[model samples]
Target: METVVDGTGRAGRSGRRWRITSMQVLCALLVLAILGQDLLREAFDAPVLQTAATVFVAICVQALPFLVLGVLLSGAIAAFVPARALRRVLPRRDSAAVGVAGMSGVVLAGCECASVPVARRLIGQGVAPAAALAFLLAAPAVNPIVLVSTAVAFPGEPAMVAARFAGSLATALIMGWLWLRWGKLEWIAERALRRLPDTEGRDRWRVFAETARADLVDAAGFLVLGALVAAVFGVVIPGDWFSSLGEQIVLGILVMAVLAVVLSLCSEADAFVAASLSALPLLPRLVFLVVGPAIDAKLFALQAGTFGRAFALRFAPVTFVVAIGCGVAAGLLFLGGVR
Candidate 1:
């Protein structure tokens, strides 16, 4: 009886520890801000700090709605759309199926986080791995929400939207074809290839809600981090770097490509973050958009877990190179040789 009571007390303590939620953290931060208001105000009074704060707020405000929308649509796809249905729609020929999969991304609006599981399910449902990969690459980048957000973010640069779409679609198709030609099935993990049963009826809504709630929590944290990084870049980075690199476009492209991988911004929110970096020319920013949804640090981790490290190691680097090449070509063609 004494052992049982002790075990119960320990379980209760563990439960309490697990209950320290994000909301609790946020409330604690809010309380600290209130307590330290005078100190914060004096610190933020610096012109650079003030600018950074403004940029951070602006990015969060502009990107939040789209982020919410992306997650909701993602949940709907996960709940309503069955993997077998997607497999049924693909053409018998692998090449044609890849094209169809790439184009299909326009209708299936979701962030990159949502695409991975769906792609895994498609593969398990007997869809061609190459075609499933094409969808995974394209869904986050070419969807209406992302393009519309890009249009809103850039406002007047219609070509930015066009270039992003063309570049992302091209990257998807190219990667799919490459996989068809050279990828090994054994590279994917046995667990990832296991088929999942589809959700049905009333259970679907439960899934939709849970998936949306979980994705919003995960993506929102990353969105906030991306905004903070953009804010710092805008104010903290030396102005001369942007100025000098603007003249050396190749160096600018390489830098933005690396930033895209490192920042790992959500597709629905990356545009606003990219737009905040007005120091760089349009081409580099376009590369940031194209490469981010294709592969980033978080995405590499996700791929490593889902497809296995061997697959991710080979696929991510190739996708990065292909995305950059497509981004540059599309920018030159659509943006007319970089602004």
Candidate 2:
């Protein structure tokens, strides 16, 4: 009876292992099937597929340097800047802190990918969640690099740059205030709330390198996914659709907002993409700029991972609404009715 029981247990274990191996093999085959470009092209015989692959590579190449810079900066901040020192520099009042945080984004130039970890670090270091959240939203949108890129992209229209900056700043400030008033403490992940241990000298450098490496690997996967999505849509959407929607301003705005979320373009390169959409009015493009940096597929996933699902669920939706409103208001004030 004992021998029979042991035999049954071994069979069960072997069967489980075999199932796992089969699943792994199936997944690998599926991935290979998709990546089989020549076979795919021969089967579908579509030029759009080729164009999409080109666009995907182009977007990824264009955004890589900025993403590297962002990750390095994030790592540096994590390693060298003591949370206590940061807290000492900022105001104690939540409102005041929010203001300072928004303005600070001008100096801490980074893409949205970099800001999530830094914001988590800030929160762990005892900074107010509202202030950290404000900084997270503002850094990518209002930074000098992003602003300059906007200026360069929309060359004869300085108003676009101003509108983008104003809309982003206002969105960040409003989100901060909203969090201050209503954000609950329990929404943040326990992991995000815990502070890192203080280190010195060589250890700091080690921490910097390790943190940057991990951030790069983690962010790169999502960045690639975003680029792939953008590329696919770029080819799938007909060119005339943009021109057709130009007449309907409200529809243009809503579509651009949704595109911003779906595309997940890096803030530095997004200006160029927005500029390329010449069919749309500047107002909708401005909405794209403001919304992209604040809440996109990549940003949403990172926020959920770093801050808690509950926080992202509430925060991302509110930010989307606030950002759309601010974009329109800024467009009116700066672009003078978006001609």
Q: Pick by TM-score: which candidate is best? A: 1
Please provide, for model 2 over 35-151, each residue's C-alpha lDDT reduced to its tens digit, 9 standing for 90 to 100: 997797696567787887877787677667766776687687667875566577789999999999998888777678778877887888889999999999999899877887788
**Which lDDT value does model 2 have at 69?**
73
TM per prediction: 0.93, 0.77
In candidate 1, what are the lDDT values of residues 1-339, reduced to their tens digit?
Answer: 122335445522223234677799999999999999999999999999999999999999999999999999999988888768778889999999999999999999888988998899899888999999999999999999999999999999999999999999999999999999999999898887887665565588898999999889989988999999988988888878787887799999999999999989899999999998888899999999999999999999999999999999999999999999999999999999975
**For each candidate, C-alpha RMSD in Å?**
2.9, 5.2
Task: Give the 10-residue window scoring lowest on summed lDDT in candidate 1.
Answer: 8-17
Candidate 2 TM-score versus the reference? 0.77
lDDT of 1 at 127: 91
